[model samples]
Target: MTERSNQSVRRAFKLVDELAENGPRGVSELADQLDMPVSTVHDYLQALIATGYVTKDESAYKTTTRFLEVGHRQCHRLEVFKAVRDELETVAEETGEHATLLIEEDDQAVIVAVQEGPDAINLFAYPGARMPLHATAPGKAMLAHMPTERVTDIIDRHGLVEVTPQTVTDPDVLFDQLEDVRSQGYAIDVGERIAGMVCIAAPILDKNDRIRGAICVCGPRSRLDEDRRSEIADVAQRAANVTQVNLDYV
Candidate 1:
């Protein structure tokens, strides 16, 4: 590809992704993230704005609602996304906690869909958030369901890095926890990803019993206490099953 063709699309996508993750940003910030000159980023933003994909607000630029309009159309066309969305919403409604769908991607766990519950606590993972496979409840659930070789590949690629004080960083401990997830049919994250937050996750398995993805319910520790742990877990498991069934996974 020529410089003009490759540079514009690549830089535009970087700006769009950065904006998607952290709202409107200044040209300098976008330039710094893309490792390009501010003038270059500003030029790209001008092109994007002209095309109606991005908008400018004084000194900052943000992706326009055009992306949302396209996203709504795309979501309907993606069968797996359509299949799990209802169950994800149901889990959030039933548990009164954040419900999310996560799938392993490029050796990382990718948050693909989410629904927030009535109460809001701070676990900043949103749709398109990429997290370490060994550092999250949904990641562990899906990992436990995967074949041993694939599990090892993921662990090898993304080591058990600590995200919080309670995060299991030791390889041995993480392996043991994976074993427990296999036996228990659910995975738990007690302040593992974020302090004072608890998460329960269950894997949606395919017809071959391979993990397709996982469903998770998250909330503050006080709300997701021992008294309601099983209840939340059961709801998450049922949601996962619902997704599998929708996919025609026997």
Candidate 2:
């Protein structure tokens, strides 16, 4: 695409982001935020509204539900699932724990695969489940690698809602944890989203080094204490790497 076309698209996306975060706003406000002509912003807003990606409030505009549908469709379109399904089953078999495949959707994590071990456990989420980007291991593993501006925007859009006692509700604390996860190349969720459950997750990267998804293993907190945490991390990381390799991921 031409540079001018790319710039226009970026400006349109920026307007969408602003509308999503700040609610409905006038075309003049949008143009000010995006530093574009008022007519240009109005044109973009009208196009987005026509596509059902945005909704008009008389002269103002805001995001519509279509963005969520778009995100869901995009989540399934990623070829990462071809490698994740069988690997999750294998991980569940080997670890005797729940295994899940989570893909990053904007700033959220959606579970695309969930495999249960032979022994029953009502612990993990099912396929098609959505979770916050900062609460779960798989979610954090993906977020930890995102660009700083993107991460900040996600935090601004959705502040950490405390799901459990272990949940990091403070943005600063969560930022520190994300940095640590990036340094370690993985993330751990110790009953953060649900009590008595622990998860270990590693990022799955594509050939371009972009994180596509995460592979995670979930077990009872008793089974994943400090003694076995490292082992669990190793197993989860290896499984994730194997899936990435099968997809010719970097």
Candidate 3:
């Protein structure tokens, strides 16, 4: 591509990202936030509107449900997601908590599906949400099953940023915890990502024993004590095993 066309593509995606992240915005507001000229921003907005990816109301421009359509289609296309969708709901229903299926992407955990039970607490989590691998149970569960060299590369790239006061910042400490997770067949999180939240997760492997993703059950700390944690761990592990078995046919 020509340099000019490459720059245009980057700028267009930047505008779309800005709208996706911050909701509707006026032309001048977008220009100021992006440090681009008003006329340039308006031109980009016009192209986006013409393509049906964005819509204008009064003086403000916002993205349309087209983005949702694209995201939904991409998420549903994953083989692991298809295999684990029912099991994720089963986990939540049986545990009375939030259940999630996540996969690693660019060294971060991407939530592919979420199910809530009758007593589940809303963490405002949704599909396509990304979380740091080191601070989440699902992330750690997957990481524990990964090769040591691969895990080291991910940690080196992401640098284990502490998400909460309870987050493990030391690399050595995290390595030790991962060792425990590998042997136990599950991983636990106690306020590591969000304060007062607890989680249990297990890695899901394919027929060849390759890591595909992870399944997790999460809730408030008050509700998941020692006994409850052990129980939920068992539930999560079973769900993960079922998902792995289902993948064998897929």
Candidate 4:
């Protein structure tokens, strides 16, 4: 592609991302935020509208639900997601906590499915939520099973940013903890990503022991004492195992 066309593509995607994140916006507002000229923003918005990816209401332009269609199609294409969809609900109901399925993409953990038990705490996590792989139990669970080179690459790309006081920000410390995860067959998060929250996760592996993704249960620390954490860990691991088995039959 020509340099001009490539720049135009990047600008167009940026405009769509801004609209998706911030909701409806006017031409001047988008131009100001993207540091582009008003006419350019207008032209991009017009092209997006023509492609049915965006819509305008009066003077404000917003992304259309067409994006949801695209995301939905992409999500279902993952075999692991389909295998674990119903199992996550079972984990949540069994543990009375939040259950989530996460897969690594672009060096980040993306939530593919989530379920809340009757007594589950609200963590504001939903499908498609992306988080650093070093900051959450499921992310760690998946990372622990990956090759050392891949893990190092991910750490190099996105440093171990401290999300909370408990987050491991040192590469050596994280590698040591990953060793524990491999031996124990599960990963733990104690107020790492968010204060007062605790999580336990297990990696799902294929027949060849390749890491597919992870399943986790999360709850408030007050509700997840040491004993309770152990119980949830067992449950999460069993859920992950079931998903792994289902992957073979499906």
Candidate 5:
């Protein structure tokens, strides 16, 4: 595509996202927020309305139910079971801690599934939660399996910003930790993302050996002491392996 075409597409995406976030905006409002001319936004809105992705109501434009359908379809397309929720539930039961499944989406680690553990300790992760790839256990689990170049690119783009005092802020230290994760077949975050919380995660791989996502068990550091780390790690690995086997990716 030409530079102009690419810029137009990017503008359209920004407008749609603004509509989704602000809900039902007029062409002038969208143009003002996007810093584009009203004429350009109107043209894009007309095209989107014609495509049935955006709907016109009186003088305002809002995302149609099509976006909801698209989101559902995207969530359902995961190779995991149609009953993937059950996987987290079982993991929570087995591990007695919060069980979460996070996937790499749009170059970020997104929590796709979550189950409250038996301990009832509140954790921050939930479905739709997004975290940086350099700070969290699930993120590191996925990052370790990616190529070194891709890892460096992501770190360069996102930077190893410290989310907490324990978060790895140095790229070199994070790379060394990734090597350790690769060797151990799992990753750990001890207050790296959230203080006082510890997470153990393992990568979920597809049959073709692609790193599909990650499964994690999270809880207080007190409970996940040296003695229980192996136990939690074993459960996380088992859950990931089972999830990969059962994933029916279309």
Candidate 6:
């Protein structure tokens, strides 16, 4: 945790980021793009290689397969999503809405799985779809449980553009909403991200009780207004708990 060590790691990460976007590159190319000394870049690259985060091929350095494997493991080993599939199906069968799972990646919420509810309504989410962290219900639920530094970084990168009349575009308000989510144990999007769509979501906690992912139910706004929001929240929370229990076995 020393300043010097942190700086070195940061520099190494920057080099990796450059290589990631620019494809494989030689030490000189990385140094030039990062504006760091060639020797320094080489040292960091070597360190990355040692940690299996990067691999050197003759003259070019690229990200290692290990990083890919690690990401893959994290995605699949997500306990909450794994645990709640059957329950989500049941919830969908009973409610006839769409049930979904979302996970945070690079400060954005990505849909990992979805189940169609019995109501037979059309919905926007599917696996691999990305949504703004500040706009979607699952996005806000995940963000509400993340570290402040991580949340601030995302806000700094992607400004809170108003996606709908209900979207909170102010950071202060978003922060306050996060607090409310923490207290209430879930988040609701009543047509905040998409017009005429209502979403209710709850955080999926891991074995460590950390926010690992989120489970949600979505349907037409007409069916999930303020009067029925509590009912939707109840379903979401139950599904989330089921997902958490599943993660324990995984």
lDDT of each: 0.84, 0.83, 0.93, 0.93, 0.86, 0.83
Better of 2 and 5 by lDDT: 5
TM-score of 2: 0.68
Give a tens-digit lDDT track for model 4, residues 24-85.
99999999999999999999999999999999999999999898888789889999998988
Which 10 consecutive residues of model 5 have the lowest summed lDDT? Answer: 77-86
Instruction: Please provide, for model 5 over 101-214, each residue's C-alpha lDDT reduced to its tens digit, 9 standing for 90 to 100.
Output: 888987798988778877848775656778898899989999999999999889778788888999999888999999999999999999998899999999988887788889
Give a tens-digit lDDT track for model 6, residues 137-215.
Answer: 8888989888999899999998998989999999999999999999999898778988888888999887777888888
TM-score of each: 0.83, 0.68, 0.96, 0.97, 0.76, 0.68
**Model 5: per-residue Cα lDDT at residue 167:** 97
Best by TM-score: 4
Worst ten in a row by lDDT for model 4: 66-75
Query: Judged by lDDT against the true structure, how good is candidate 6?
Result: 0.83
lDDT for model 1: 0.84
Pairs with backbone N, CA or C atoms under 3 Å apart (clashes), candidate 4 = none
Query: After superposition, which runs of candidate 4 have C-alpha atoms over 4 Å from their true positions?
Result: none
The positional error of residue 26 in candidate 5, measured at the CA in angstroms, is 4.8
In the predicted model 1, the residue pairs found to clash are none
Q: Any runs in candidate 1 off by more than 4 Å, and if so which?
A: 1-9, 32-35, 118-125
Model 3 C-alpha RMSD vs. true structure (Å) is: 1.2
Which scores better on lDDT, 5 or 6? 5
The residue-by-residue lDDT of candidate 1 on 42-153, one tens digit each, is: 8988999999999999888999989877756755665567679889888988888888888887878887788987875657766667888788899899888777888777
Pick by lDDT: 2 or 4, better one:
4
